[model samples]
Target chain A: MDIHEYQAKELFTEAGIPVPPGEVATTADEAEDIARRLGGRVVVKAQVHAGGRGKAGGVKLADSPEAAREYASAILGMEIKELIVKKVLVTPVEDIVSEAYVGVLIDRANQAPLFMVSPEGGVDIEQVAETNPDAIRKQSVDPRYGLLPHQAYALADFLYDDPKLVRQATKIVGQLYDAFTKNSCSLAEINPLIVTPQGEVKAIDAKVSIDENAFYRLPRVEAYRDLDAEPESESRAREAELSYVKLDGNVGCCVNGAGLAMATMDLVKYYGGEPANFLDIGGSSNPDKVVAALQIITADPSVKAILFNIFGGITRCDDVANGIVEATRRIDIKTPIVIRLTGTNEAEALEILGEAGFSAHTSMDEVVQKAVQIAAQA
Target chain B: MSVFIDQSTRVVVQGITGRDGSFHTHQMVAYGTQVVAGVTPGKGGQTFEAGNGARIPVFNTVEAAVRETGANASAIYVPPPFAASAIMEAADAGVALIVGITEGVPVQDMMTASALVQDKGVRLLGPNCPGLISPGKSKVGIIPGEITIPGPVGVVSRSGTLTYEAVNQLTQAGIGQTTCVGIGGDPIIGTDFIDCLEAFAADGETEAVVIIGEIGGTDEQDAARWVKDNLNVPVVGFIAGQTAPPGRTMGHAGAIISGSEGTADEKIRTFKESGIAVAERPVDIRDLVKEGLGL
Candidate 1:
């Protein structure tokens, strides 16, 4: 659930964090209007859910409104890591004296939101942590009490020596944590927290990833999803409560559990076949889910065969068998389907499959190997 | 004897009136687990009829359930929103162990609840897990009792159906397990490979161990190092998500490769370095287990 930089800045503003005013434009005309209103040099940043935006030529510093439109028009349809830039953020440029990194994220190892601050900024923090770990100072915040004022100051002190700069940095750190917790974000960062020559601290670039599990509470953050940046199959699968990740392969994997889904995909490669996609039918026992899965898989023309390996626990195998039988009738599935189901009414499942003129295997290895062979041949 | 639970372990079911809770409650009772009490917040002062005349008392809170039934452990099946609080409730009630089976709980909530768990010195198994089964003794959470049998091997996994798949294979191949634990696949689970392995190492009944891990955290690698230095039992390991793409969370929130970290190849390499046999496929686990047992 990665939101665009402009959306993150909006949240940062709401939290009383200082961010340069920016407007998101879906068109070049809109970008030009935004730049003209700002009446100064502006930065046009491509709003795509990916890194390397600068390297992809998706970011440009425009000295005029006409230049802003030109940059936006060029970046709008451009792809960075295969994500099309459908929107661009037009913000007035800032005169920076220095840059620093500040961020907070749910650290799995610490079981809390961990704040990381670095004097080095405007680069991949992961790379920095790897090459020069000492440059980055980290603090694990107690999610119960959140980032205390003193705790924020300790992290802020590492980024600045000036009293005014440290004070602003400390406030920005607390404000970032506020935005992170309020939006149920998994990660929130202000890369290149620039120190203006006028002695002001402001966030120039923002990245925030929302935790989908918290969507039940944060309705506004959930609405920040950009479908234009997502793959069609992925968006469609989400509509059906299925977790899908498309891959360039011939064997289409449909499994019951997440871990099992990955293992099935791995086994497809182990048997010398690439998996077309990773689709988890999840705990939904509805035949419609199976129909949805079939439609999503067959939509990809590269899918030579469909493989379903369901070790039913909470998910019923009979329901899946019925789903396969029902889906084949509902949708004209030309791809050869191979199923391997075991546990939880397996006999009834096998009977349903047999009656539908489809033979199913109970061994995971056999079905994966069979599907891989069928895909390779097709 | 199992690592966590034995025949003497008393159980309390949280969210007992819910769909999954009531269903697994009956399943647990049918398998001879001592499900003494149930909790449903407002549905207290009632009896949940778990067939066979097993009328379990329902309390409004975990505290009352623990006090009334002397329940030492809790099996949680609450909704995602309330699941973390339910875990904290059980921990606050002084339960030694709490097994959370609810999925979709916010990581932030678990972050707070798990920290409280550590402060309370209570063991929380999972907020999204299949729980544990002590083959033919006592079972907690949702592991199917039919697939297990009392034996010398102990199993620890970070998956649901995958654990069932492996345990079923072991049972079908006559390699009965003493207990099979699903520590869960969430990013911030309360227990990890190290905790389960330590419990198994202390348990005298566990002759051999099988570690089932997936791509995500460095928990498996950390467990590998700990096993190499401390434990002496024969260990066979399996790492899922070998072909999974980086950055995309494959089914589990925690099962993702971040910047070339927590990959199956890396975990497998570490397992080999720690002298653990790595099962290339799920079915290969049976043969590997047999080999480890020298059978």
Candidate 2:
């Protein structure tokens, strides 16, 4: 789960990492007020769940409170990568002598948290990786031992040559590890780990993404979820035990598992049709869950055809068939519906669908082709 | 000659009194697996009426269950929050193979659990996977035994139902498997494709293998390298998520194509370069397997 830059700073501050004071403002006037309180010069950054904010013109440097208000007005409600800018972060501009990048993320191959420190900063990390891979130094921290003091000092050397600057960077590295592991963050980064002429190192830009699987223990952090960043159908689908992602297509897909769901969508595209959405009814599905999935799929206006491909294992096909039958009674769906169910209780499911005036196929290829054909005709 | 589970494998079902544990335990017994014991902390001394009239003993802890039943393998059905600890407990109790059936375990938890299990030299399969099944012999985890038949093909996958989809297609087409393993879809899974591939390579019965992969990480690429370097047997592969958008996780937490890496195109390219046939769709898996095995 991606949090706003300001929210990440809050976590950094909690971990005793030095960060410039920042305030989140919802209105242009509020941004101006925050700028005036912080100082005359401030940076107004659009607070949305996206990257390349500066390139997208969501970030602006203001020389005065009036300029801050103007920038905030222009940034707020502006769409960057299809997400509306609902809030702006106002912070005082700082003087910087050097810029470096420091980050920690879970490394799948190593099965541990990997700390990366780069001499260069504030530019695209991926770009730097492709261009000058030598600039980046990486160290994997054993989750059992954490970032050892020597490991932190070793990683800190990549960012600075001065003793004082290296010392401060080392401390920030330790604190960053704390913020990452303590918060159960999958990724935490500090771009432009700036150093002033005074030999002080601080995090100027913060980005932290929490692991949603840990939300069972971190309720307070779960409250940071930005509902506005997600679509209404997605939020509603979560409530109904479904995983959904909206797309620009005509065939709506509802399947049993994640891999099968993606495969279903891929097959739809391969058969010359675009999927309206990606929906997983999930394992252990019942009639009610199937009904909920159908309702959500039919709710999309771009969906010209609906397809259900369930290879039931833990899920019973008959249960899903009952749900589809139950959903047709509740929702007035005008789109064409296609279903292909095989596996446990297949005979019972086919009987249920046939009696309900629905034709169910056994072959995944045949069913996907039929749905694509129907959607093309529609 | 199966790789992991066979008729001789003694199984213990963790969280056996719980909803999922109880349901799948009966299924395992009904399939002729030797379900020797069950562990449900407070339900110690209670006996579970596993199908086939076998009264399996339930113990309070994995340690006690292991001691009493001499269980060589464990199937975890605990909830996500404590699932990592359950994996650790199974390893601590000296189980040779630990198959974690629970989904949604925190990656941080797995970081510690997976490392500890590795240090102990124990094999941990999935924290979010349907376990393995050696058809007509032994069934462990949640994979349905009825969809499988004992034969020459071995399967490893990153999905639950999708594995079933491919396996069912194979079984219906008169093809059978030596053992089908679901390595799971979590980013920090206990086992990877290479681990299962190595096991299948060692087994004499596994003539051909089917590898099912999706977007996320370069594990599939590494597995392709392993296949090219180590194994000589024919391998057929299928990668889902060709039409999936980048940065959006498709249900499985690990099934997302981030940046330029971990894309279906990249995985498919690696598979072809390694001399493995790539299936364009799930339904195409059976024919590719047939072509690889010279059937």
Candidate 3:
């Protein structure tokens, strides 16, 4: 759900937020052309998902179009914080007098939307919070009442000293809140909302995470989903309706729930094995889903073993056990399968597996240890 | 003596005509829950029954079921997209408690639905949780029936599978739960640790409470304060996210980028100050809860 700076700026512009005119260019020649069109003095920013591009030498300033082209050529395809730079955002450089941060999110505890404003911006907000907590002002907005002008003004006052600047800041905060509520954004942030010497406030950078659950209502936003951007196994898992996330290990894990999957990974590591992935088969035990999960795990050559720790409740343990017993036949699982079955029909599940010549354990520790040992051998 | 649903609590199943709706409904009934009515949008006047075909009438809406059968609690199996509307319908019908087992309900919808439910004085447990089960008492939602052993440890967690992990750990460590609730993995859940803490505080059967929280949100801090000020009962807390970083989203859609204040270290420090024992490892939750109870 994270878009590059250029993509975020495109969204901000569509929302009528003032941003410097910019064009995304993949080639050095194209970047120079774009820089010339923006009057030769432009900032070349690497397009990556992560922040701190400037500090990482992924951002550069060009005095002329040729310089922009050189910078673009140097950055293109370069790995910046693990993200390969495919394009560069070339924009007209701006004069900034001050910078501030503003963001909105749903405060679950109070059951209200919360808006935060900090006097200092552009740097990591966590440092500001740790160093000077009082500088950050927060307001919880009632959904029924919405974020009013007074609340925005109160935050704006903290963010600015001059009356004109305060007024402009308040308007921007209002607009940000509008975008947050309307777009179903879990977080809508304007980091380093800059103020030029002319006393105008504009959102210089935008970071947004639209609520994925709200994707049905916002088809246009859902279109922004880049399946290719994700790991191949993950995108494939999604297509199969299995929840899977890649982890930093070699042993592939398959569990029934998110919490259990994480615990399984943690336990694997505890028992001296690195979990390669986190996969949840959900509550259903359809053999097809199991086969799909096995296929995804086996697809990763790093996977030395597979662990199935399922506490079947709605999903009968027998169903999962059967699925595993059946999945091995459908998919060629090169890795060892360590199964832990518990809950409803667990006895039947064990019997079913025992009949199939599969040795599954009732204890989680035993199963996890076995997987780790098997992986170590591999 | 348990919090929320007990054996006497009358249950109503929403979306009971569907596959999951029917399956869990039957399982709950078989586990000895007093399931009195089923609600499906277009199927009114028909009846669905479990054991021995002892019929319970189906209604088109939650209000109709409540009026006809006096069903006061609801377990919703409606899919993610329609879950918000279903919960709203249950709240409108004046169900005292609702447990939504459906996952993937957009956090925004849950936020709005939670507010609406709160406005109507209805308590919601979760949208993506495994539901709540009080052994030999009442079962609502979909926690496995066989894994529970009715005891004094009140369990609460943000993840369904982690709830099972805590329960299994407790079971292995010779600790049993009074009632275990999966608050859900989603960041903006219907209920939080504070709400569950309040319930455990008042429940006579709960000798101690075990809480499992994740990396995002300030709920852990809030719960720590609540446990310190209001509750006399012993509490043990284990906050997840040892390897997690701030401003990074985790598994749950509701989880992520909550800021430095909601980190695991901060929460653990606060909980320690509040006199609650902090479990260093998730597997130690049961031992911590047991020790907190002086067991």
DockQ of each: 0.80, 0.86, 0.50
Worst 10 residues of 1 chain B by lDDT: B251-260
Candidate 3, residues B174-219, lDDT tens digits: the string is 7778888887777656777888888888888898888877767788
Model 2 chain A poorest ten-residue lDDT run:
A282-291
Q: Which stretches of candidate 1 lie over 4 Å from their true place?
A: none
State residue B101's C-alpha deviation in candidate 3, in Å.
Answer: 1.6
Better of 2 and 3 by lDDT: 2
Evaluate residue A282 in candidate 3 and report its C-alpha lDDT on the 0 to 100 scale: 85
TM per candidate:
0.98, 0.99, 0.92
**Chain B, TM-score, each prediction?**
0.99, 0.98, 0.93
Error of 1 at A288 (Å): 1.8
Stretches of candidate 3 above 4 Å error? A227-229, A351-357, B165-177, B228-250, B255-295
Q: In model 1, what are the clashing residue pairs, if there are any?
A: none
Instruction: Give the Å error, residue A126, model 3.
Output: 1.9
Question: What DockQ class does candidate 2 belong to?
Answer: high
> Could you arrange the candidates by DockQ from highest to lowest?
2, 1, 3
